[model samples]
Target: MLKRCGRRYIVGAIRTYAKDIRFGPEARGLLLKGVDIMANAVSATLGPRGRNVLIEQLMISPRITKDGITVANNVQLEDRRCNMGAQLLRQTTSNTNNEVGDGTTTATILAKGMASQGLEVIRQGQVNVHALREGMLEASRVVCEELQSMSQIVETIGEVEAVATIALNGDKRLSDMIGDAILKLGEGGVFLLKESKCLNDELKVQEGVTLPEGFVSPLFANQGNGNRVEYSNVLLLATLANIERLDEILPALELAKSKEQPLLIIANDISADVVKALVMNQLRNCLRVCAVKAPSHGSEQRDQMQDLALAMGANLLENATGLSAIEAEDLGVVSEVIVDSSSTHLLHPRIHNEDQVHARVQHIRALMEEAITDEEVDKLNERMGRLFGYLATIYVGGANELEVSEKKDRLNDALHAVHGAISDGIVPGGGTAYLRCIPALESLAPSETPEHQIGRDIVRNSLRLPCYTIARNAGVNPDEVIRQVLEGSGNFGYDAAAGQFCDLKERGIVDPTGALRSAMSEAAGIASLLATTEVLITEERIRPKVPRNQVTKDLAGLIGM
Candidate 1:
């Protein structure tokens, strides 16, 4: 019998590997070494005092950053197997950063320590993987309860700023901007990112809405008189038809031209001939119209187009095999259309039917009240925002391209962090949140058997490494700082920025509970996976290579030598 991933094997893929495989100690050792290598690379940038890593680009200027994701992403190891192993662990950090924001460094460090420590118990081969897994999970359950018990409510704008500040590694300017933006946007309001208008270290947020779709040609840009064209009563025509043929789109164009209305066509594609005609007609000042490809492709994208159409009282057409009738009642209305090179903006369009909009809103709210998990709530939030309040944009600026790029990444982290804090309660940042769970973790020690004890102890103590790194990176001794904090009140921890120990929450250094929990779960899960992995069969590592003599002959033949 042979093991198969699903029902079949991929073509040109390794099937049964008797060779090119590492097992037991050798495989486990490689995994641990990979974790260690990556951990050491990122440990330097763990706290507010954490320094940036400078990486030189081949054809451009160098990049310097303290962002853990940036460092992890830039790494490429010589050993492919080791690199793959490190990447698997890095996925834990990636998800944490993507989902809740922040804690990439903490997540990586926790994973390294757990996998390193858990390997010892796993090597004994006395405790089953299931048992170790159970012990870890139970410890997590306890830690989570402790986190809830210690969480601080985030109800004000200041608290939101605090969370964003900590996540951005203490960027006060960025933090203040994020806090103000979130407060101004209020509930269900969107926060979008845009490039800076000027090369100055300034952060600005404007009230605006954008769709992923944009206009096809700049020629139709409503730059009437070199001023922003306030194009109104624009029809949003969504269809799957290729309106390239003159007759198909001619009716719609003629109808809009007659009514003195602008037509904003959204379709899979329009004929080049049609686009030329539209541009020429607009140039002659006889018509105002632009044809842009519908955002997204395929069925899902078409459905989104239909949804937008329905919301705007526009007619949606499908399977239009020939020229179709264009009706005035099928047209949609927008308050204004602002076109830029990047995207087209449609501002505050009315639904026209207030009673119906209110009823639909109440129904969606009911469904949302029953929704759980981030994905469900996110869907509803987006739906509500699209129907009612529109999304806003924040333009992050800096003195240079590099600075703006880095600031954008930092602002993204801050944005998500602020959102997470608003949705969930806050916990003390700077590692104090994890350390606070130790007493609870240890409380389970008395009931633990020897096998469970080893796993449980690792989980308990590994939590301190994050704080240790935070303190050490701050130019202080972690051991002394930890000792002092543990001796003092539960809330107190080492603040490397201030170069002293203090209460983390009181000083406005806090994290969202959701981010912390997501990171912890991801770290523990990956560590368990690494510890339990006993064999490594790298198909890529065993691929046959072409001989140099053959390659040389091929090159010589090409040159007619």
Candidate 2:
């Protein structure tokens, strides 16, 4: 019995801890292979003349895109080790995306180049891997500082369009619309992109607030062809009360139904069964109603709802009793309401209580003046924006669904780039900003060790990869372009589209300094990790069981039966 138990224990241990392990050069080489494969695919779409990748999708038509993150997300490898490496690279791209919302392509190439070069150095021996990683990390910080100092503020609408145009892949119309929207909305503005039936894109700017909380249920979006629940001349009921049963708000619903007016309910909470009943009633045309949970919580929720109530000239219901006692005259009127799953927009036709609105604005400004922390200041600014902000929606038009998807992807990237620029500023573009940092990076620091120097060298050398890839994609000799850019000083870089050396900033070609900084820093950190890694462990792939009949047929075929 002891022997049997021992055997069972051994089997269970094996099943529990089964993993495929790799070590040393073999592991690093396989990882580099993965980095190469993914980087190569994404690098093709690096410049103005860059090529689009056609991606095969399941349950939908294939998508053709020039977006780097989209390409990286679709990569899957047959080899587990390679897939692990690919996934690591994907992390780099994702980090860059989350940090800056653009420059995923640049980040991918930088990570691949840094990892590959670092591996080659490791193969050459003599350097401490830990020291090398430390050096790279330090070098990344220095480069970011240099880029920050080199960045110029985007102070003009033309400059904004220039940055947008590059990110949008030379779409002037889209860039123009985005620039106009940015200019009109100013700082802390909110805008949305929507698909348009027309072949030409359209833009609409309005004065309103876009709340983070959207419709409580999608069924409330029945009025529109898309997911948006839109209403004209709607009545709004704002309350801090939680609706536990349908009877809680049945009177208000009946009032709206009798008045033949659309009603929007902003409450603290509504039970699932209550939401279901509301949805069903709307679907059956029993009532024209939509429900959304009020934005924020506690005191914040009260303040926002009060601000909204003030704007709508409605009574602020503080408890369940007020909600139950709601009347037709108690509901506030709004010119329009647009809601999606993620956000809600309320537009007032005109300020109902103009003096009260002004007083509220002044009170918020006073609070801002007395604010002690950055968070407080930000919250006040957001409240101010909500009260008097411009909400713009860009209706993206395309020839078909595929074109629309691709265009929307590009537009989102551009929008993010614009935001990055606004927050941090803009720097030289087309890899020029990275290439210019090599000299400073290569300069030896006073306390740098030999291994640190080698590591720093690896990063500085790898920095040239973006420019080289862009030139190669543009069908130019990358070496000559690099040499020329190095010889020229101060914002001089190769224009892959124009195939000549010119002033990048003068040509209106630039990248968000924040995006480039994020790309370089994230790439350096990940590549250093990959370089120091000596062990790779992954789940052992299990083979599916074959049926006895299929196995027998295979054996008979082997015997020529």
Candidate 3:
């Protein structure tokens, strides 16, 4: 199947095949090699104080950032192994981002570490694949629990401040501003700022209170133009009136008049007679009037109403019946009436004071808190849980801050697969699910098993490429770094039977430096778990190619072609 594809295609097919197969050591090694290639590229930019860089290649130039998502999306790689490895790293990053809205780098490193150590156990014949997987699962659980337990409470203003502080540590002012905005808005209203606009100084508050330009009507106008009317001693209505009932309208108006309030009937619609009666009553009692329309009916109308309400006021009443009249009565005002057509009956509005407003705020806050808490608990209890998925990470430590920063961007691109998985909840065992599959690989290995040997070789060889790259950059011999990595694992590269490095390619051996080791570990784990997983690969339908005519004198000037 691979041979007919030609050399480049075959290599590509093999690269994909290695990621898709889940048996023995050779497959594991290939997978690991891919992972390491990607991880090492990112490890350099892991710290909080990391800076940014500019990456200029022949075809593209990207202003590099330490942000995991940014980096993961930008880096370029040609080798099939590198590409696959990078993909796994990306998946881990995505997983982290989706789950926590942060922590892609952390997950990437964790997966890398598990894969690296799991392979060693396989080589040592101390544990089978199943045991290794169990260990990984246990480790993941421990890690996730630790994270969740760390400052889970975000109740007080101080706690919220602390969250903003950590999230925007580099720019204390930005954090301070967010904290301040939250404080100013109190608990009821959310402080919504686009991520990009968070730091912009031109932001304006346009909702809630706006000073009247002149002698403006107390009634807040609905978006529609024709549905205008006036009121005095305004009974503010907050509901959709979609029903047709003289019975409903009459009672609500009577209640308003009992309070001596002039009703500003805000509703979806009112009968012509109902409107004329309200106008007549206002003139008879010397009452002023104002009326605003409610949103239309149906899903779109509901959505618009919600949006309008949210933008205009912090508190909203769900039932829009006779509440307007009730509120006017409380305020010791004259008749105020409100009507809603959708309701079975009309309701009197209740005027809310500062105390009522504060209560409403607290209610909203409690609701949000309850929701978050419930979600957190549910996530913890799931079979996969928050911690069981990809926790692989790559930590890049470097003396040159800029170089390290640049590598972070590259590494993130490589880990896109993991990142995405974390964002969108994963299927039990899918692509990038290998982070939880290390134990399965270990189980397949045995004492003196060729599979085990292949896994080790793959891991070791994978690390060599990055080690050499780093060594060369640092003005050291690539071979020296490669040897150091092997020695650190209690292994020697000088095997007479393998004929040194001459037959490494033939024997499926490669350099196993730290980067390669980590990458391979992650890739192998992902492959083991997700290899049999099938995806509904959607092929974009090809559009008919349009032929371009050669530019004539007339066209050349117009197009500047």
List candidate 2 segments past 4 Å from native: 1-17, 209-237, 240-318, 322-389, 446-448, 546-561
Give the TM-scores of the predictions, in the order they appear. Answer: 0.74, 0.72, 0.46
Per-residue lDDT over 1-561 for candidate 3, one digit per residue giving the tens place of the 0 to 100 score: 465657888676555544333344554455566656655555444432334435554434435565655566555465443355567667776554443434444345555654655555464654445544443443333323322222122344443433333233233444344445445544322322221212233223222221111112322232135233333444443456542555665555665556665544445665666556555655565444444455346753443443333322323344435433334222222122222222111122223244543453454434443444434422222211101111111234444544455544333332322222222322111011122233333344343544444444333233234334333433445575455444432122221222232322222221112122233334445533422222222122233333466545446544332
Candidate 3 — which residues are off by over 4 angstroms?
1-45, 53-65, 73-88, 116-127, 145-162, 185-189, 194-250, 262-264, 269-288, 295-297, 303-561
What do the candidate models score in CA lDDT, each in turn? 0.73, 0.85, 0.39
Can you write out model 2's per-residue Cα lDDT over 47-146, one digit (the tens) per residue?
A: 8888999998755888999999989999988788998888899999988986777999999999998899888989887659999899889888989998
308-406 per-residue lDDT for model 1 (tens digits)? 665566666774552367676666677676765556666655544556556656776687666755456555555555555465556767677678767
Residue 480 in model 2: shift from native, Å? Answer: 1.0
The predictions' CA RMSDs to the true structure, in order, are 8.0, 9.5, 15.9
Q: Is 1 or 3 the stronger prediction by lDDT?
A: 1
lDDT of 1: 0.73
